[model samples]
Target: MMKVPKGKTVLVKGVASIKGECEVLGARLNFFECEKFVPVFCIEDCEIEINGEFRILDGSTIPESWKKLAKMDWETVFLYGGVDSGKSTLAAYLANKVGGAYVLDLDIGQADIANPGAMGYGFAKDVVSLSKVSMINGFFVGSITPQGREAKCLQGVARLWKELRRLDGRKIVDTTGWVKGRGAKEYKLAKLEIIEPDLIASFEGKPFDWKTFEVEKGYVIRRDKIDRAKARFESYQKFLRGARILELERDRINLKPDLFRGKDVTQFIESVLGV
Candidate 1:
């Protein structure tokens, strides 16, 4: 255990524990494995026991704008940013600050509240990470990225929002980093139309025509494609850890886009294959 002086800031990556008056983004730090380095500010003199790696920074990494954003009374706040832009970190900070806020994670590729290929929302009374929070509900988008599944992604968003609207308290929405080109622009616009959030907090400058609160991308660790794929694999393993198989009639279950919507094509397939 190491004693941290009051007003000192430390960036910890990997396994660590903190005891005494210390806060990570306005929330108390406990035993946690830092996937990326998270800034821990010593409110008072504290002891931190670390196993992985740490860096004593010059000052706190938390931005003034983030503190200001947290204090606002917006009912619904939408987060816009690219990958590694600290969107999830900001979401967790805001959730901790707002108290009892609901986080709607639409970044299906790197989902925090649900498995890959799906979106989910959870009630965050206090959270160091959204991935640890229990999912209140989820909508399957059937794909990790929103490239070709843009329509399905939007559908999932709308469906999840329908359920989210019924719940009281502030809402924080985190979206994918697919915000470029005309297609991405159109997709985001369609999403905005459905969500209509009171505030749009952007980390990637002001890309939207609508007014947005620009936020600093503080202390982010960029992950490569291999890292992302590995993360997704882990998510899949965790989600399907308790495996079970159940047989149900075809009519009892619903399939999106209904593959059998058209007429019988068994004969055509047989003819083509010469079977």
Candidate 2:
């Protein structure tokens, strides 16, 4: 049975997209701009408090451990979840909170920092919309979904992180909202192995069972729910407005299983673009 009681205790399992207004017992979910409460949940022994009161989780995408890490000079953070889960919003928020950091956006579609069908990496100098963060480099994933492009996505993620690791301050990987099926799970787990980030934080949805890493799930109440088409269009518009074009140097790119092992960079780019 679904959650019947609405005092504060809500037992959410499977997948439930919140349409009307809803609240979590002790979740501080005021850090997003769109419909972000939708959850693709898997309940085991997971139990939440039901105080029937409003309290602040302190508006953080990370768990309490993040606070201690924040006091340090820097760290590597990864924010991941399904669509409308506020992954991008929280990542941007933390980037600003952490003073400065290198943000690597792995969302192929509706990417916050680069054009669709690619992964972008750059340094966040200040708190701003993801589109405003100029992309220092990118790797083409060739497809919006990582079904056939799983290898490409993994390579892109590893390459981007390696290329940007030299930058000072915290490092962040803003992953896609593609946590649905078996393929998605395998792809994310594989990608995480390559990323090996210090912190593996997820938004409202936690699909993978990577218990060893112990994902930190954050909750938020999203007001707007934008689809992929709109998100992509909006992101592109932002990039076109003031983003200065920058070229990717081949030597800087680090792909373990090079997609273009025998092909030149131009050929690889053209192939990925399907041109």
Candidate 3:
């Protein structure tokens, strides 16, 4: 419980002891711990050493670059990076900075603008959680994964890219950390071809055939850190907490039409409930 005066930078070692916005002079962080539901780090021995006049700690590897990019007429901006590379944070930051832009999150697995198993497009009006705006247009992939579902995932991106064309602003496509091997490269190439963004930003790994900008750092947001699984579990439960329940008549919707073909599986429902 110490005051980090303005203009005085603070040093943090991935601890919860420090709070308030200060330029990250340096930080070593990890997304998740090996344990199932453990905290990301132990902050008991952490310390924040301040120096000089307090200043807004918003400096990043691409602050000026983002400013310049935001001023440009690039209608569609694409971001590619590895895991925990701050892709979502950058998209949200740039969407707010650029103004009048919609962030179309294509990271179905680690989705920001939507739940874990869906693609979503929404505007980043404020610094709120991206999930708050996840309801704009959610395309489900039926699984909390994107490894073998590249087709559906890319289709989601391409479909939403078309939907973005209906809007009157820029589009920021935040991608996943699927830039590992040959198949992934090909899949990403397909995504690039579908979106055909005017500008590409890469925080890590190389993406081909575009007017690309390389951002070395800004790989993680400095505000909050948590365990990945814990965060997902919380989000999953939060999503279903107040979910709407629907009741339909038995004849109103077919319960697996194929499964009941040439048979009367519904006989059980009829015999038991006599619906």
Candidate 4:
């Protein structure tokens, strides 16, 4: 049985590019200009209240223990970095700092939490239940398969954003760095525009030359090598027009497993989160 959120109207952002409906609940959804959907359901039979005032729940800080901090104004934060740039470390650290902010593991293709064949459920799982967290592990889409998994993953992310907006805490989105930091595909790019968090914090040691790429049907396409080399001022004009950008500098770390051997991830967490 599908659960329809009750009362106060579930406000969805952006509009869907395609026409669709909630298969289980049978709610009609409309596609808006930006290709997003705002689906609202009337859950008259359920006891769950859809009011805006709900508390976040992650074990780092209980909702009851910190009413003042928990009730503070919430902001959605995004942690993005190339492979091995410590995006997850930063996300966990920040989530811990804010007490009970939600942490979504958006690295679905290369997931580390809340996926099959992993060890015990980790902090990521608890974060989803008690906070505004959604889809902590990357979606299950095999690169070699002929399936439509990538498209589904994109929809999943959009749905997650809609759900997160309903909760009362901050949102921390963890992104994947597929193919050397480029996003996975066109679908991922579409979802990015829809989620549109308050902050997009990029962690990279090397100075980012935004003009080195061009947007071709949503994906960032590399420019001609020689042309890029000689350019004095490159234009990341397309991305700049779409959203604000924030870059963070940290000691460069590679995604290679061996280099990070025996490192205490918790210590990294403390460095970012601070006690």
Find the 10 residues in a row with the least total lDDT in model 4.
211-220
Q: Order of all candidates by TM-score, from best down to worst?
A: 1, 3, 2, 4
Model 2 poorest ten-residue lDDT run: 36-45
CA lDDT scores, all candidates in order: 0.84, 0.59, 0.60, 0.39
**Residue-wise lDDT of candidate 1 within 34-121, one digit each (tens)?**
5667788888888999988898976678888899999987999999988889888899899988766899999999998999999999
Candidate 4 regions off by >4 Å?
1-74, 116-149, 179-188, 205-275
Residue 180 in candidate 3, Cα distance off native in Å: 0.8
Candidate 2 per-residue lDDT over residues 1-275, each given as its tens digit: 23332233233322333322433222223122222222222222223333222232222234453344345443776676777676665666567666667789888876767788888987765433566578999988767777787666766876787778777667878888888788887777777777677666765434455422323444545434455577676666755697688999999998698454554545554444445
Candidate 1 lDDT score relative to the true structure: 0.84
Against the true structure, candidate 3 has what lDDT?
Answer: 0.60
Best by TM-score: 1
Per-residue lDDT of 104 in model 3: 84
Task: Estimate, for each residue in 217-273, the C-alpha lDDT of model 3 and write its tens digit.
Answer: 442444334566566666678678988989889888766645434324345323322
Using Cα atoms with residue i matched to residue i, what is each candidate's TM-score against the true structure? 0.87, 0.57, 0.68, 0.38
TM-score of 2: 0.57
Q: Give candidate 4's root-mean-square deviation (CA, Å).
A: 20.6
Positional deviation of residue 7's Cα in model 3 after best superposition, in angstroms = 3.3
* Candidate 4 TM-score to native: 0.38
